[model samples]
Target: MEDINRFGPELALLIAAGLIVVGDVTLPMRGGTRRVASVALGLAGLAVSALWSLVLIVADERGNAFDGLMVVDDFSLFFNFLFVGIAAVIILASVDLLEKSRFRAEYVALVLTSTVGMMLMASTVDLIAIFAALELQAISFYVLVAFLKDGRSSEAALKYLLLGAVSTALTLYGMAYLFGLSGSTNLNDIAAFVAGADSGTRPALVLAAVFLAAGLGFKMAVVPFQMWVPDVYQGAPTPVTAYLSVASKAAGFAVVMRVFVVALGHGLISSDWSNMFAAIAAISMTLGNVAALAQSDIKRMLGYSSIAQAGTFLIGLAAVAANDPQLLLGTSSVVFFLGTYAFTNLGAFIAIIAISNKIGSDQIGDYAGVARRSPWLAAGLTACLLSLTGIPPLAGFWGKFWVFNAAVRADLVWLALIGVLNSVISAYYYVGVVLKMYTQEPANDEAFQPSPYLGLAMTAAVVGLVAVGLYPAPLLDASESAAAVLG
Candidate 1:
């Protein structure tokens, strides 16, 4: 029992993935077996997550684990639970979508495997562990993005693979440099070596760091490395799109936070990295918003929107480098924003999936007069869109407000101001979606019936958005504790 507890939540997901594969292959034929298998996998995942959370509550404060390859600190634990929760929600959301498509078993298995990969990424404190975990997630996503077996899906997967391979190679090369410099792959050892190194070695270390940053930046979809986002988001399945927007992005941030704050913060590296990140943040936000303004495809628009959000998260990272109290605030803000963003984005995709099933379109015009056809879905979408717009009393507003407040507190007042302006600019497009849903008359007054599962998913998301907007204290507090663990 203690040994099982030692492996903690990570084992649950791996076991669940294995169970899903075996059950799919061994189960006798039944009418709803596929759905049952998916549900069982989700339940198993949830159970593991709950147990892991309990461990976090009950376990001692010792953070290091797995021979210092991982850390079971509050920061990692927070994201561990978050990844599991998101995976569970995705599993629920995927049931209807998967049943309608072929390759149901493979989809469920891959998602579970991806969740496990993300969990490992969040917990690890070693560079080798980071690379292995990232590959685990990346390989699963390659299959997931191309699961549809369509030309567009194939193209998206190929593009993602080619780019991902390059990033991986770059990251590996960077790691080799660090390993050569420190003579160890352990993050703690690397930090100590950098702290003690002379000026002669600084340039090499900086170069390696730059390459590593670029590789991770691609994962976060930061500017100059975000070229693949719109196409991948537009071409992948809706559920995969949601997963990419939420789980994958969160995993990237987890690695960034650990790598920068814990590993690099103790080094002799100059403060120049902060300025570089500030520049990246500015470019990412401006470019993402500007590009999104022209997108007619809803998924592509959301993809660009996600890029802007990535910039905001980077602002949090920049704050950490400044050693400002705002780092705490920024960490909390990022966590809250990610939580609400997951719910809202997933809600929007749920609506899209439901409507697309009925109308077979992903164009913005297809959403016109959606309220008349499916009021429940339209209303849910309205809430999500409003949240995305950062409208008052919606979940997104508070997330943005906290994030900008952190930037201001960190004395990046200009960045905060720009973010606010971008938030306002975003409102135009989000409201356009809403107005099209409510004001325009449907070309055909055809009634739309939504799947019961999808309807329930949307309902839960709507409730989440409202509830989180009204009372953000609990989530904020949790994030605050998580941030302290990082410190």
Candidate 2:
């Protein structure tokens, strides 16, 4: 019963996914009606799970299930809420776009199923379990990316599948090495082994870390391993792109923290991984920003932008590996930044969805005089872009502030400087979009309104963004508490 209770949230979501499938097959309904029904079912499941997670948080419930394969704690709970919330928002925002699809119920099922994997990724403590969770998520994404069945979507899914296979192999090979070194799969046991391992194991450990970093780097969309990002983001459905940007990346970082901070943060090789991540961070930021400067497509631009933001995230992860007094701050900064970013990035994409639904174009030039076309959408997108630029009194600003502060505190001043410069470089494009929206003349002045569902999603995201920006303490404190669990 205790084990079952610990698994409640996942179970609820899984049951809902199953029911969505069953109802889709069993019930007779039109495509549009079925999509609405599926969305309702999916949202109900997410709500139940989210409420249960809240109950656990309030009761201070914490425990390990499956003999420590999966753990329920503050860290996992934080991500649980985050993943569920992202899934709900994505579902809501996708309904209009997906209304005409024949298999919309399957779409919702895939989202719920993938979200379940993401939650497990944050909760699992065993290498085997982590691998399973990652695959569960990746496979669902493979299908989601191609769900549109258009030529571009098909090509993107193919590329994603190929690259994803390579990453999986790399991750598995690294896990093999770690198991060979530690003779265990459980993170706690592995940590115990790493603490006492002699100097001879250093070379093998470094190799393992390299492979692990490369594999996870694909999911996080960091440089060199980020070749697939622009193409995939451009080709996939916009709502899927939004979900990938926030929820998928967060899960990758969650696993990185687990494997790196929990299992490998012992005395040996700490500096090695820190230096590696710092180098990757610098390169990713510079490359991503430089590449984003020339992109004409909004989705492609955001794709490159996400790579740069992922690099900033690594700044905090690198700081966590510093093994200094700033460890807590570093981890918490990463968590808090992810939260704020969820609001900022999702708002940007949701607004884009609303705008593009009417304009029927993704080119940056198409956004000209959007303020005149749809004032609310222009304002929302502008606010999100400003946040992404790390402008003051906005959520993105505080996210960058905390991460950079953590970097400075951990003595990564050079890396922090690189981050700041990249942020400046990023502003050129982010603000360029804002400028085109407000300053340029409209090609045609046919004003349109966003659908009620889209308006609700955008309003919720923007409100969260502004609220978090004005008073960051709640998120900051929550992040710190979650980071403490890792500590």
Candidate 3:
């Protein structure tokens, strides 16, 4: 009973997904009616999961559950709120898009199902549990990527699945090495063994670290592993792209922190991985920003920009692995950055969905005179883009500030410098869109408003970002508390 109680949030979402499927089959509904019903059910389920997580936190109910396969703790709960919120927003954002499809219930159910996996990814402390949770998430994403059923969508999904399979194999091989070395699958047990492992075995540990980082890099959408990002982001439905940008990336970082910091940080091999992450951070930042500058499509541009953002996230991770006073700050900064980024990226995508649904094009040049077509949407997008650019008095600025501060504090001054330069480079493209929107003439002068659902979502995201920007202390404290659990 206690275990079940601790498992309430995930169980709630899983049950809701099943209910959505069963309800769709049993209910006498069709078309828009069915879509509305499905969206409502999906949102309801997410709300319940979020509320239950809050209840647990308030009740101070934190501990290992499912025989320690999963843990109900501050770290997992932080991600639980984030994942559930992203899923709910995606559902609301998809209401208009899903109306065109007959598989509304299936789509919503898959999203909920995938979210459950993400929650578990953050919750699990065992390597086997991590793999299982990741596969559950990846499978749902595979289907969702192809949900559009068009040629491009199919191609994107195929690339994702093929590349994902290779990454999975690499991840499993790495895990096998760890289990072989430690004779255990649990991260705590692995950490204990790693702390006492002989110096001669350092090469084997390095190999395992490389494989794990390379495999998980795909999920984080960082360089070298980011080949699928542009195509997948452009081909997948816009809502799915938004979910991938924020929730998927957050889950990847969460697990990476758990695996690297918790399981490996206590050993001499920590420096090896830290140096690797630092080098990757610089390369990903440079590559992602430079590539984004050449993109014409909005979705593709965001895809590459997401890579750059992921690199910035690595700044914190790199710092966290070091034995320094900034360790807690490093991990906490990443958590806070992820939180702020969720609202920032979701707002940008939601605004794009609103504009593109009417403009019928994803090209940057097509956004000319958008401020005239829809001033509010233009304003919302501008704020988000500026936030992405790391401008002050916005959520994005503080996220960058904290991570770079952590990097500098950890004595990774070179990585922090690279991050600053990349942020400057990113401003060019982000502001270019804003310039086109306000200064150029519209191709056509027919004004329109976003749908109420989209308007609501965009508003919520904008508000969340701005609110956090104005007063970030609560979130900072929460992130610090969450990161402390790792040690």
Candidate 4:
């Protein structure tokens, strides 16, 4: 019972997956099966997440479970909750899309399984565990991205799989090198080994770090490594695109924070890897913003925006590696930024999906006269886009402010400047969408009726974003406390 309690959340998700499969096989019914399965899985996920939150509040902060493969520290607990929250939102927002597209029971099961993988990735402290969790998540996403069974979805899945395989291979090769050097797959052990390594061996350690960084960068959609993002986002189903944009990115960053801050803290600060991250930070920010300015497809533009956000996040990593005394603050800033990004991005995507469903297109021009057809959707989209543009009194503004402030405090003044400039550049394109929505005239005289479920979901996201933006003290405090555990 105690063992079960320890792994309850994961077990719950696993059971949810099982129930989905069993229900699909046994019931073999149509019409409402998809809805039933999706709701069941969503409820199970929410229950597990609630339990995990309760555990975080009641249980002691523990580390090193499963023979040191996992760690239930504050960092993991925080991110576990974040992923679960994102999953719940995705599930809720997807109901209308699934019904319209006639998705099967497998869709729910795969989403649950992928979420479980993400939770595991957040909690694991060993290299092997990270690899396993990553692959599990990747496989699920590969299928999810291609679930539409259309030519475009198929092409996206192929690109995702091929690139994802290469990234995994690179990550594994880097892990092997690290194992060879440190003689252990445990992060703690590797850190200890690197801490006492001779000068000659340090260069090889940096090389291994570079390789690992590259692999994780691919997942985060950082520049140069972000080649697959635009295609994948454009071709994948809208819900899958939202999942990839938020939950998957959060999982990647979770692993990055654990591996670097908790596992390799000492080694990274004392080695050349810090400079590498700094360089990557500079280049990624410049490239992502520049590319985003040229996009007309809404999803493709968001793909570039995602890459730019990743670059901003890299500044946090650079600060951590530099041993900036404000590491906790910096980490908290990143987490808060992610929360804000998720809400705004999801809200924007929700509106996009609603509009696309009505018009059957995702081009920027399709958003023209959105205000005339659906004022509520236009308002939601405007709020989201304004937030994403970092407008004051909105969620995105606070997120970027905190991150840039943290960067400045860490003495990365130039990085902060670059981040500010990028934010300004991003505003242009973000507002462009709003302009098209409000200024241009509608081509047809038809009223747009968004699905009630989707409208509710978008309202929730928008309200959450505004609430968080206006009152961020509570969330910031929680993030700070969670980040303190890494120390």
Q: Model 3: residues >4 Å from true position, as ranges?
A: none
State the lDDT at 185 in candidate 2.
98
lDDT per residue, candidate 4, 100-149, as tens digits? 56555678778888988988888887999999999999999999999899
Encode model 2's per-residue lDDT on 54-99: one tens digit a residue: 8877876789998999999999999999999999999999988787
> Against the correct fold, how does model 1 do in TM-score?
0.95
**Full-model lDDT, candidate 4:** 0.82
Per candidate, the number of residue pairs that clash is 0, 0, 0, 0
Error of 4 at 452 (Å): 1.9
lDDT of 3 by residue, 266-352 (tens): 887988998899888898999999999999999999999999999999999999876456779899999999999999999999999
Q: What stretches of model 2 exceed 4 Å from their correct place?
A: none
The alpha-carbon lDDT assigned to residue 258 of candidate 2 equals: 93
lDDT of 4 at 209: 78
Between candidates 2 and 4, the TM-score winner: 2
Pairs in clash, predicted candidate 4: none
How high is the lDDT of residue 123 in model 1? 81
CA lDDT scores, all candidates in order: 0.82, 0.94, 0.94, 0.82
TM-score of 3: 0.99
